[model samples]
Target: MQPHEKVKQYLDTICEQIRYKRIHNELREELENHITDQKQAYIAQGMDEETGTFKAVEQMGDPVMVGTQLDRTHKPKPEWSMIVLTLLLLLTGTFIRLYTAPRETNGLELFYRQLLFTVVGIGLMTLCYKVDFTILGEYSSILFFALAAIIVLLMLVINPVDGRFIYASYPLLLFPALFAGVVYSMSNRGYSGVILCGIYFTIPLILSLLIPNITITLFLTLSYLVILTIAIQKKRFKVNQHHALLLVYVPFIISFVVAMTNNNLIYRLKIVFTPSLAPMGVGYMGNITRGIMKGARLIGQGALPENLQGLTVEQVLPLINSDFLLTYITHRFGWIAFLIVVALLELFIIRAFVLCARQKSVLALLVSTAVTLTFAYQTLGFVVTNCGFYLFAPLSLPLISQSSHYLLVNMSLIGILLSVYRTGHMVHDKRFPEKPDRRPFLTIEDGRIIIDLHLD
Candidate 1:
């Protein structure tokens, strides 16, 4: 074929490929069927198959050019407006709690702290967005090392003699330090950074429970799991080792063996099923479960004056506002409000998963998986720790967490997600110019494909 005819044939081949591949399966099938019919028509018009195919190719134009066009149409618009709405809801709720609740506490102090946390989180997110995430992979070891250092420092606080008061809180400071360390370590080990991060949070979860502060542990775990799941589903991790059963089974075996050998371990394990077994230790969960059950009995009646008599929810569970804020919300706002909060959280999880599945971006998929897993895991943990009257504890929900640490953690995640949505390349594709110049096309390198176009 002449150069012009060659170009036409090339363009047609490209267009056909794009038509069959990128489109919905049904649509692609239909388009292929139509192309077959067109080929037959050309043959009937006294054209040979080669000439007919060439005609089909000529009519189709540049595939890259068409793909680019299709991409423009398909790109998911950033949900800036919904993001703003979520932020507003969070801020409004914070404000209500700060100034206008049935009673108010250090409104100014709470506002300033929360505002500072949000600002810092946003700044970090901005930095991450500007830098390529792939670069972070190079520094995963160093990052993990730093996190390990933090965990060691936290471990020091775990000793009461160190005057660290780790026990006073659920080794509160150690939770973040340990989680970040584990995640970093996993990331360096060529695991999915996000999933590793989620797994790492389990350290804090276990410690929090040991401190008998199931609320905070559950919340932190949830946040971490959601983030990690997003990473896994997106294939952010280097390996796809399906080792969930092994991971869980090994831990269970170790715990059971240790519990049989150690009285303390046995005692703690017993408390898992029967909180009454370890009154002081299990009381945290029991009290939360009982309080919510009591409130459930009242339903729309709201917190009774008798129930409100100088009794702080914090007295029932330390850091109740942040970790066990749901109790307060349900108590004052009623069961309907509780249901709404749960529903909204479910919606966010579902949306993240759906968007991840639909998006062509691998990174976005990873991020979505991270978020979904984190939320689902945490939520389940929270319910387990709180649900049955026999088992209960205060745990904060995502986005609605009132604790300064939990709030900071949640905001940091949101900021990262916002950054990803704003700056990510959703899918990898290349588009060539529709009109070809007289210059001869040269060899294309990896990730590069060129199509020469001709009007005739």
Candidate 2:
């Protein structure tokens, strides 16, 4: 290929970097229009039309540089602090889980699973980072449909055969599906797209209520809603300074009323009200609450026999390993460790939101919002439930769980981050001349390689 041909290939790749269908259409139109304008200018410069066009194209700068620059203008500066915080939190959580938790028959096995899962998740995250997330828009609907099918398989197909299902380990895939839907819809239809995406997730969530997997259902639905809320908020309040704020509690009010009227809901609500309620129900939360409370007394010494009594030795907490991993932290590492965990979670979420705000493409922003919502809501739910209220079952504990489902979910979030960052960094670091690599060259029948150089 000639020099100009190489340039065209590079531009095409850069355009693919921010590859939303809507944006792609716009970029194509823009490139064609620019090319035409350039050709006209070349003709005016006293040269043969074709020769003028060729020289004009070369003089305008490489197409790749132009396209890459456009993409970069929309990227955000990397936040190193959040990355460090996430790493520290994940590493510390793993250490505490391995060394501090009470031993059981599956002790070594569980530890191995947790460690292996983390490695696998990080690898998956790296893979996600390798591509631009905007490419995910094309498969958003498929992903949503697949998740729905999987939910069905777990509830109907797998549960019956195994007497249980493994949804908890990685129910977080709901975020990517819902997020992709939001990105696609928002680009095509604006805010209404968001509302439709919410409805899409909500329907399955309500359906899941009766499927013995309410936690996963609720988690998915809540994540979708939270993301939509962010979009709505962004629409309501653009950047710069905020004026006055009116905090509304419409959903909270409705939920409170519903719980008050229903006995089962009331029982569930009690979990959030009193940690003690856990012991009376499934033994998961109750054990966690009792263990954390007891563990907090010692704060870092763990639940050794010598200090067990001092750390609420009389209390017998159940499920100290999984749902109640927080308790294990308090028992072994102390309240400080628990606080650090919370801080790290908050930092991870905040960083995600920042990415959403800084993204060049609307789809990336919305997807980032969805990812943030999923992690934030789950984190809040986990914390609120563990604080003494036993309102819900133990969901996957993010980075702490050995469940394959949870592990995948956590990795998916990381994937979103890394992918977005790769694109985002380019936008931030090189706003002037972003370009992709050149295309492969081919020999022509003539002495020189001939190339048809359409800007688009």
lDDT values of the candidates? 0.49, 0.57
TM-score of 1: 0.54
lDDT of 2 by residue, 174-241 (tens): 54445554434444233234335555665565545545465666666556555555545554222111
Q: RMSD, each candidate, Å?
A: 14.2, 13.7
Displacement of residue 304 (Cα, Å) in model 1 is 6.2
Q: List where candidate 1 sits over 4 angstroms from the true fold.
A: 1-77, 80-85, 99-108, 125-139, 149-281, 297-320, 358-364, 378-396, 420-456
For model 2, where is the 10-residue window of minimal lDDT? 239-248
- Stretches off by above 4 angstroms in model 2 are 1-32, 42-48, 61-83, 160-164, 186-195, 232-260, 274-295, 298-315, 401-404, 425-456
lDDT (0-100) at residue 265 of candidate 2? 70
Weakest ten-residue segment in model 1 by summed lDDT: 428-437
For every model shown, what is its TM-score relative to the native structure? 0.54, 0.71
